[model samples]
Target: MLRMLFHPKSLKFLACIALAALTFSSSCKTVESSSGSLSEKSRTKTDVFFAEMYKKYNPYPIQDDPETPDDCQSLFKEADPSVPYKGVVVYFHGFTACPQQFYEFAQIMAKKGYSALAVLMPGQGRFPAPFNNDGKKTINGRKYKDYYSEYLPVKKGDDWKRYLNFVSDVNTFAATLPGEKLVTGLSVGGQLAAYAYVERPGLYKRALLISSYLGMPGSYSGRNSTTSGGMLNSLRRLSGDTIYHITKAVSQQGSNLDIIADREVSWGDKCYQQTRGFNGNPGRRGICDFHVENIAAINSLGEYILGQIKASPALTQIPQIQYVGPEWDTGGDTLLVRKAIGYQKARFGDDKVNACFFPNVVPHSMFARKDIAVLPETPWINSFMLETTKFLETGATYKVSQEPSEETQWDGASDQDSGVFQNRCDVYAVDYSKVSP
Candidate 1:
C-alpha cells in the first residue's frame, strides 16, 4: 500500500490538492481597516473586494502589458472638497467596457461642480490576453474572434456574486459623498443601476439609464449561435479541476493566433466604417467582446428587477428616473424600455418617470463618448450635458423634440439623401402588461 501511494500519479494528485489549498488560502485574506476619511472607507471596501476577487479568479499577478491603455483603468474624480458641491454621480460602464466609457461624462460633471466616480465593473478594464485561455489556436475554431478580446474569465455564479458586491460597495461610497446622489449606467451597467435603485430606493436622488438591457431583442436572440457552446463551456468549468484543465488544453491546441488577429482587425475596420463619428483608430471603440455567462448574469439581474416591480406594485421611495433608448439599438429591445418606464410609473406615479428615444442615431452605447451624437448641425454632447445638469439640480424632465428633417452630411456620406432625424420623447403611458415577451 505504501509503495502504491508513492506512485507518480498519486504524487501529481497530491500536488494539485496542495495547489488548490494554497490558492484558497491566499485568496481569502481578512480585509483590514485603514485610517482615512469617511469616503476613504468606502474606497477601502471596494479595493478589498476586488483584491479577493482577483486573487481567486486571476491567481497570477497582472503583468504590465503595453497593449493596455490608461483610460481603460478605473477612475475616481473628486470635486473640490472645500466647496459644498451638489453631490456625486456614480457612473457604471457597460459590459466588457472600461471606465473610460463614462470618463468624459464624469469630467463634464466635475467641471460643473459635481464630483464623479466611474466604477469599473468586476472582470473588466484588463488586458484581453488573460481571458484567451479557451484553448483555441486558430481563428476558425474561435467563432467570436473580433469581439472576444479582453473579456473577463467569468465562472458562472461566483462572477455574479462578485459583481453584486461591487455594486453594493460603490453605492455605499456614493452615500458618503456630499450633496445629492445620482446614479447612471449604460447597457449591463444600466441593469446594475436599476438594481441599485430598486435595492436602495432612497440612496439615489436621480437615476439615468441609457440603453438599459432589460431583455434581448428578438432579432438578436435569433442570430445568436453561442447558446449551446456557452452551456457546454459552463459545464466544463463546473467540472473538477483536473477535468477542466484537460478539456481546456485540448480546445486551445487547435487555434491559430495570427488568423484571429487578422479577423479582429478586419472586424474593427468594418465597425469604424459603419459607425458615424467613430474615431478611425482601432481599439478606441468600447469593448466589442461578448461572454454568454456574463450575458446570463445580466439577464438574471433584469429578471429580478422585473419580479420586484411586480411583487410590490408601489415602491416605498423610488427616485426620479430618465430612461434613454436608442431606436437603432440592437443589443436590447426598444419595447423593453417602454416596459421599464411603464413599470416605474405604475409603481411610483407617472410624474416620477421620463423617457427619451434618439431616432436614426446611436447604438446600444448611447451615452458613451464614442456614440454621443456629434452631427455638424447639432452639438448634442453639450446639450446632453446641460440637460443632465438640469435634471440633477431640480429633477426637471425634458421632452424629446419632434423637429423637422434637416439635410445633414455625415462622415463618408454619399450624395444620396439622408433622411431627417426625429426625437421621440414622452411621459410613461404604455401598459407593460400588454407587451409581449
Candidate 2:
C-alpha cells in the first residue's frame, strides 16, 4: 500500500485505489480525476497534515489510551505561513471525517484563486480501535486483536472545545494574510464556520457551509446518552508493531449503533431508503445517514453552536450566508438555516443571508427520488470549490420554492412520496459586484 501511494500521484494513486475498494457513494458514479499531479506542486513535503511529529512536541512519551496532549495549543497545525493567499479560505471537515477527504473542495478553492487551509479537528483522525466482528470462524483470518480506525463518538460537550480552538486558530491564521478572507466548511465544518462567525465576528468575511444546518430545536429520540468510549480512527495501514495513520477512519458502531429516529424522514432513513447500495455498502446512502446524529442532536447542536456564534461579537455581526443545495438539502438544512439567518448580528436577509436552491439531485445522498433535472453529475467532488469561490465573489441571492413549474407531472405535484421539498426558488447569480456597499 505504501508503494502504491507514498507520494501524491493523482493519476496513478487513483488507479491504485481502484485496485482496492475506494469506498465512496452508492451511486457508483465516476469522480473526475484532478487535472495534475500535486507531487510536482510545491507543498512543504509534510508527511501528515497535522498531529504528526509527536516526539518533538512532547517531553514525555504520549500514550494512545484516552489520548490527551499537554501542549495542544488553541490553534491548528497550520501550513507554511509564507504561502500567501490572494483570498483566504479556512476549511473544516465533517463527522467521522478526515481533512484529506476535502481534497476536492480544497482544490476547488485553490482553482478559484484562493489560498485554502483545511483543518483536521481532534478526535477525528487516526485513533486505534478494534474491529467489532466477533465472527464464528477465522477463514485465514487469524483471530488476533487488531486495531483499525473507527469513529470515536465525541463525549458530551467535548466537540465544542475542539471546534472553538480550531475556529480561533483559523481566524488567527487568516487575519495575518491579505485578500478576502472567507470561512467555508463541509458537513460539520460548516457548523464550525457558523460558530466562528458569531464568536469571532468579522474574522471571516464570508461563510460557505455545505451540507450543514442552522439553529433549530431538536426532537429527541429514546437512545443511549453515554460518552462513547472508542477511538477516533484514520485509514492507515497496520504495520508490523505499529498502526500507520493514512486517511481517517469512520466508526461502524458506538453510541450510534443504530439509525436515527423515523424510518422515512431522517437522512439516515433516506440513505437506506434507496434500492441500490453505494460504494458497495447499502447503508451508506445519503448525506444525512452517513455517520449522522439524530435530528434532535442535529438541531440541538446547531442551535447551541450557531446560537453561540450568532451571539458572539463580530465586527459586522452578520456575515452573509449563501445557502446552496438541491431540493432535498434546501428543505432539510435551509429550514434551520432560515432560523439562523435571524440570529446573525447583522440584520437577516438584508442581502446578508443569500440562498440558492438547485432544482437538481445532490450527489452525496440517496438516489431513490425523482431527479429529472439532476445537475451535471460530474461536478460532485468539485462543486465545493466552484460554489465557495463563486459565492464569495458574487454574494448573489437565490431561493427555490417547492412549487413545481408548469411542467409538473400532475398540476405540478406528484402523488408518490416525494419527501419534503422546496420549489419556486432561485439560483444565486454568478456575478455580483461590491457586497452590501
Candidate 3:
C-alpha cells in the first residue's frame, strides 16, 4: 500500500493539484484587476500637470466634453497592482483620438497578465472648439455645428514639449510595476512611440508601431494637397493671419477661383469611414473627420522622429520592435510604412525588428475597438496579443519568408482565391525584401 501511494503517477497527480491551488490563490489575491487604480500621489500629479498645461494653451473646457471623464482625460493602469504583472504597455492613441482608442487593447493586455496605460495626447479627447489666443473670449469661444469649422488651440513647440513630458511621467510610473516595459501606438501615436523608444534607450524592452504617419506615399499627391490645405487653415486661425499669400498666387495665375473654397472642398471627406462606433453611423458622428491642427501636429511629430533617426543612428536600443501597416490604409501612406521599417532595420538590425501588413484592412483605427473583426486573411487580435506578450517575456522573434503570391495581394482578389486565406494567419513577421528606404 505504501509503495502504491508513492508511485510516479500518484506523485505527478499531487503536483498538478498543488500547482492549480497556487494559481487559484494568486488570482484571488488580485484586486481591481480590470480597472487598476493609481496611487493618490500619481493621480494628483497628473491632474495638476494637465491643469497647468491647459491654462497655458487656450483652455478648452475639457471637463464638459460628453465623452471625457470629469476627473481625467486619459485611462491608466489596467492590471492588479498586488499581483505580479507579466509586463506593462504604455499605449498612445492616434492623432485627434482619445485614450478610448486603446481601451480594448488595454483590456486584452490585462487579461494576459500585463498592465496597460493609455495616455491621452494634449488638446485631444475633448469637444472640438475654436480658441482665441488673445484671451478676449472664453476658452470655449464659439460652438460650431460642423467639426471641420472648429479650430484647436495648438502652440506647435509648446504642445510637443507637453506631450514628451506626459510620456515621460507615464514611463516613470510604469517603472514601479514589476514587469518588462513596452510602448505601442497608432498613426501619430506610433510616431511618438518610436520617438520615445529612441529618446530613452534600454528603457522600453519592446515597441509596436501601427501605421506610423512618417509621410504619405508619392502617389497620394492629390489627397495630400487637400489634407495640407486643410491643416494650413487651422494654423491661419491661431496665428490671426489670412491666406492672402496663397490667394494672391492663385489670382496671379489669371483665374478668379476661390482659394478658400478649394481648400475647404475636401474638409470632412478625407478619412475612410470607420466600421465601428459613432463614426460608423452616418446619422450620428458621421465620418471620422480629421482635425486640421491635429494633422499638422502629426506631421510635425513624424518629421521630428525622422530627424532624430538621422541625427542619432546608434541610439536606438529597444530589444524587440514590431511595426504593423495596413495594405489599404487611406489615412497613412505605404511609403511611410517602408520608411518606418527601414529606420528600425538600420538602427536595431534585421533580427530585432519585424514588420507585417494587413492584406485588406484599410481603416487607420484598425485596433481601436475589441468587437471589430480583423481582416479574414490577417491574424486575430488575440494572436497578436499573445505574440506581443511572448516577445516581451522571452524576446522571441517570428520571421516569415514566404512570399505572398499575386492572388494574395489586395488587387481585387476574390475571397476564394487561395487556401492560405482560409487557414489561421501565420505568426506576424517582417519581410525585409518588401521594405525600401
Candidate 4:
C-alpha cells in the first residue's frame, strides 16, 4: 500500500504541486515589492484622493497585477502638479475594457492644462487569488477554461449596482477637483456617462458618448435590434419570476463556476476581437470574454436610466453633449444611440444634443493608436482628437471629419443619399420625431 501510494504518477503529481507552490510564493513577494516601489515612486494627488474609494470598492487589496500592467490600471494625468488645474475630464471605458482605452485622450487633455482621470471599474483587472473554480469547470465529465483569458469577477446580479456605485464614486471624486467636471465614455461606459449626466442634473459641464451601447445587436441576440429599455420591457412581461430568480441566484454565486459550464449553451462564443485588426483598433487590453448574464445586468441599468429620462418633466443644465460614432454600426448601436439622443432632444431641445457619425472609413471604438493609424485618407483621427480637445476646453461644437474634398462634393447629405466617407461628416441634424422607437 505504501509503494502504491508513492507510485511514479503520484510522485509526478506531487512534484507539479510543489513547483506551483514555489511559483505562487515568489509571485506574492514580487508583487509586494513592486507595489511598495510603485507607491513611493509615483503617488500623486489623484492617487491620494482615490485611495479611499479604492479601499471601499476594489475586492482585491492590491491594484496592479502581473496580468494587468501599470499603464492599463486606473490612470491619472496632471501635467503640472504645482500649477492649478483648469478643469477635470473623467473617462469611463467600455465593458470588458480597462482605463487604457482612454489613456491617449487623457494624456492629451492633461497636457492641454485640464487634469484627466481614467477609472478602473470594479471586477476589472486581475485578482490576487485564484477565482472562479480556479478557472476550470466540469461539463459532461470534461473540464475546461477559456484559453484566451482568465475568468473575471464581474457577476450578473450585483454588477448593475456595482457599475452605478462606481459612477457615483467617480462623481464624488471629481467633485473634489477644481474647475468644471466633464464626463465621457465608450460603449457601456458611454451609457454610464450619460446616466451620470442625466441622474445628476447640472453636475457635469459636458459629456461625450462614443459607440454607446444603448441597445442589443441583432447578430448577438438573434432578434431585431431593440433598445435596452425595450428588451427589459419584453423580459419583464415574458420572463417574470423565472428570469428574476435565475439572475438573482446567479448573482449570489460566489464564483463564476456555473457560468463557465453554461458558456457554450447560453453565452455562445467569446469574441476575441471587435475589429478585424486591419483598419480598426488592432488590439485591446481588456478581458476578451464576458458572461451574457452580466451584459443583461448592464442593459437593465440602461433601461432604468431610460425610464428616468422619459418620465422626467423637463431637462436642466447647459446643452453640452456630443455623440460620435461610425456611420453604420451593424451591431445596431448607432441607431439606438440616435434614438436615445432623439429622446433627449425632444425633452431637452435640439441645442442640448449634438452628434457626428463618420462615413465608411472608421469602425467601432475608433480611438486606439492602430485604429487611428495615419493613412493618407484617414488623417481624420488626429483632427478628431484636436477638435474633441478644443470642445472640452471651450464647449465649441466639433465634427469627427475635416472639410470634405471637392472630389467627394458632399455637404450634409442624408444617411441614405450618401457615398463612402460622405455620410454627414458635419453636425447630425436628426429629426427627433422621425427617430423610431
* Top-scoring candidate (lDDT): 4
lDDT of 2: 0.38
lDDT of 2 by residue, 1-437 (tens): 12223444435434423422332111111111133332322222222222232212211111111111111111122222334335756766554333444443444455445655554444343321111223321213522111111122232344325445556655665576557777766556677777767667666777766656442211111111242532211111112111111000111121332332211122222222221223322121112221222223334446567656455444356566765544334223444554454454254534566544444344322121111113334333233334455576555444344554211222223233222222334433332221111
Candidate 4 local lDDT, 186-279, one digit each (tens): 8788888887776677778889887777654321211122234222222233334454445434434524546442342121122222211333
- TM-score, every prediction: 0.61, 0.51, 0.60, 0.62
Q: How many steric clashes between backbone atoms does each model show? A: 9, 24, 0, 0
lDDT of each: 0.51, 0.38, 0.47, 0.53
1 or 2: which has the higher lDDT?
1
What would the per-residue lDDT of candidate 3 be over residues 1-437, giving only the tens digit for each residue? Answer: 22323554445434433433443111111112354365666555544544444454313333122222211145554565555667777887776555556655565566556776665566553432222224332333432223432433222344545556656666665576566788888877787788777777787888888767664322321122223332222223322233333422332331243323233212222222221223322111111333233344445556567777656765746658877655434555545555556665666577777766554333455555421323343334444555554554456653333654222342233332222211112445443222110
Residue 50 in model 3: lDDT: 40
Question: Which parts of model 1 are misplaced by more than 4 Å?
Answer: 1-70, 81-83, 128-162, 219-286, 312-315, 371-379, 402-437
Residue pairs in candidate 1 whose N, alpha carbon or C atoms collide under 3 angstroms? 128-150, 135-251, 135-252, 136-252, 136-255, 137-255, 137-256, 138-255, 138-256
Tens-digit per-residue lDDT, 150-268, candidate 1: 33533344444555666777777667666788888888788878878776769998998877876544221112122353112222223233433332332233122222222221123
3 or 4, which is superior by lDDT? 4
- What RMSD, rounded to one decimal, does every model reach? 15.2, 14.1, 16.5, 12.1
Pairwise lDDT winner, candidates 1 and 4: 4
